[model samples]
Target: MKIVVGSKNPAKIRAVKDVFNECKVSSKDVPSDVSNQPYSDQETRQGAINRAKACIGIGEIESFGIGLEGGVMYIGKQLYLCNWGALVTPDEKIYTASGARIPLPKSISDELQLGKELGDVIDVFTKKKDVRQNEGTIGIFTNALVTRQEMFSHVVRLLKGQWEFAYKN
Candidate 1:
């Protein structure tokens, strides 16, 4: 099957490609239609769903759309890094899933609380440019044990598995 991923972000595209190696996959820059820094799981998941839903009729190929969104959420009082993924088929059947969450260091969480996006804060924290396009905050926090691609891939797998179970007989 052909798949059209909702974002051109390398890690997200790589997750889809890696997880769906047999399919013809392509990506487009679709709007998540949410705040640049999604503050809760609900918003993050909605961003993914919106992006996926936005990908319909974008290209000539009959394809499914997959979206991956990363953001932070406050659990109790501590903010944690979180991510979600969504997939939408041509028929508009949607599947969604969330990935792991890890507590942020107070220093980073404080920066986020200051209204800075995680991607921007991470760049300054790691002193690297475009960390989000590379390993992402998950990589730095987890010491590279869980890369951005790996995390999104887990979510994509869940979405794909759910779709398969629901649609494939």
Candidate 2:
């Protein structure tokens, strides 16, 4: 079976590719139809589902569409990073899973509260360009003990595992 990722982001694509190594995985530019920085788990999971559904059957090939989304949410007064993933089969069966979350530093949370995207805020925070495409804020916060790719991969694994359990035939 073929697999397609909804975004061209290397980190997201790599997670799908790495987890579904036995399958042919590719990437497409699909819209998530959500805010640049989703501020809640519901919106973040919706974004992932949107992307996953949008990427189905590209080039008329039977495929699995995978979507990875990163967002931030507040649990009380603290803001935290949240990640979600979705897998959509050619038949439109949907499976979703959430991944690691870490609290954001006040400085970054301040920027997010200002309506700035975490990608842009993280770039400013790290004095680096395209940090989201790399290790992401999770990497910087955890000192690379965990990475954006790994977090997404964890979600993908959960998605696939759930799908398998539901439709193991």
Candidate 3:
């Protein structure tokens, strides 16, 4: 099986590869068609869905399209990081799952409030360039206990489980 990921970001691509070990995975750059910094769970999930749907049928090959998007959510008075993944199967079946959430420090939340992408803000705050390409925010917060790729991989597995369950029952 061939899997097409909506974004060429390393973390997203790696997550798909980790979860779909038996498949041939490839990635393409696609627009999420959402805000650079999605600020709500609904918007984040929509971004992933849009990307996955947009990438479907591209290259004229049979493939499953996957999209991964990370954003922030505000709950009560605290801000948290959220990630979502969407999968579009060859038969047009759609499945989605969410990754873990981590509360953001006030300093980072302040920067995000000014309309900055989480990746960029994280890069600046962590003093690391393109952290998303490496360990990512999850790695930083968890002290490498959980990486961004790992988080997304879990979501992909959850989506696959949903698909499997639906097909079996």
Candidate 4:
């Protein structure tokens, strides 16, 4: 079976591979740009949609395209949250995961509103640079030993479900 993944991000790629591996299906990565816009939830979903659309342009190939986009949100007055969006090809299906809505300290969250991403704020808190790519939330902060891959594993599992029917010939 053939699959095209949208980005070159190691974590994103790894998660995709883990899912296919679980289902005993194989895939490939075809680099493409997905939107970074944080509009509405649908916009986030569209980011993934565009990638799957882009990959289909490759032509005459039997495969699926996958796209992933992640973002953050503030809920009520006390909670901060993150989400990951995924898209699968041809059928243009979508799946999303609602991440932990851990409330940021006011000082840190206020900084985020000024345009900094959560990783930057997290870096400042941990006194490290780009921990999101390295140790993720688990490595640099708190006693929680969860890497980004671990957090997104559920997303991976969902993708595996798609491969079943697709790979069945």
Candidate 5:
């Protein structure tokens, strides 16, 4: 099978590729210039659906569209980042994850209103580099308890279904 992934982010693409490789399916990166608007949880799902629809409208070549939309959620007095993701294939089958939550302080939320993501703020506070892409805030602040690769793999495994089924050709 040939799959077309929708995002250009290396981590996400890599996750999809890893699963495909194990499944003996080929894959390719085909970034969609979509704005990735995620107003509501349902709309976030629509964003993924839109990407898949767009990819299919473009051509036919065993395709899958993957999209990650980050959003803010309030729990009590704290704010958190929700990294929701979805995978849509031409089969119309969809795989989605609600994403992990990254709790943030009120001060951080105030700073984010000025236009900065959690990673940027974390980097500023910790003096780290591309903290979101690599270690991520959780990984770095948690003493490397979980690397970004590990997290990505975990989520990918969750979204990709059974590990044994995916890996066994």
Candidate 6:
């Protein structure tokens, strides 16, 4: 089986590989077709779905396409980080899942309110470069208990379950 991921980000690619074992995995840069910083669950899911569909069948390879997107949402007057993953199978079926979420500190939320991507804001706030390619905000917040790759991996696992259930029924 061949799997194509929307982004070349190592974390996302690694998550896919971990969940979809024994598959030929490759990545392509594709547009999310949404705001760089999505502020709602609907937008975040849409971005993931868009990327997954956009990369389908690229290079004339019959492949499953995966898209992973991280964003923030405002719930109960608190801002929380959210991660979403999407899978597009060769049979034209789409599945999606979400990872764990935690409220961001007020300081980071303030910066995000100014229209900054979470990665950039996290990089500046954490005083670390390229955090997205590494542990990510989840890692920083959870003290490495749960990393970006792990978060996406969790979602991918759920997506796989969904696929199994759908086909089983």
- The true-versus-predicted C-alpha distance at residue 17 of model 3, in Å, is 0.7
* Tens digits of per-residue lDDT for model 1, 104-154: 999998988898899999999999999999898999999999999999999
Instruction: Summing lDDT over every window of 10 consecutive residues in candidate 6, give the lowest-scoring window.
Output: 54-63
lDDT of model 3 at position 42: 94
RMSD values, in order shown:
0.9, 0.9, 1.1, 4.2, 4.5, 1.0
Question: With candidate 6 superimposed using the best TM-score fit, by how many Å does residue 148's alpha carbon deviate from the native?
Answer: 0.2
User: What lDDT score belongs to each candidate, Candidate 1 first?
Assistant: 0.92, 0.93, 0.90, 0.55, 0.57, 0.92
lDDT of 6 by residue, 3-57 (tens): 8999989999999999888888899999999999999999999999999998888
What is the RMSD, in Å, between candidate 2 and the native fold over all Cα?
0.9
Per-residue CA lDDT of model 2 for 1-169, tens digit only, reads 8898999999999899889999988889999999998999999999999999998988656888888999998999999999999999999999999999899999999988899999999999999999999998999999999999999999999998999899866
TM-score of each: 0.97, 0.97, 0.96, 0.69, 0.69, 0.97
Candidate 2 positional error at 68, Å = 0.6
Model 5 stretches with alpha carbons more than 4 Å out: 23-60, 162-169
Which regions of candidate 2 deviate over 4 angstroms? none
Worst 10 residues of 3 by lDDT: 53-62
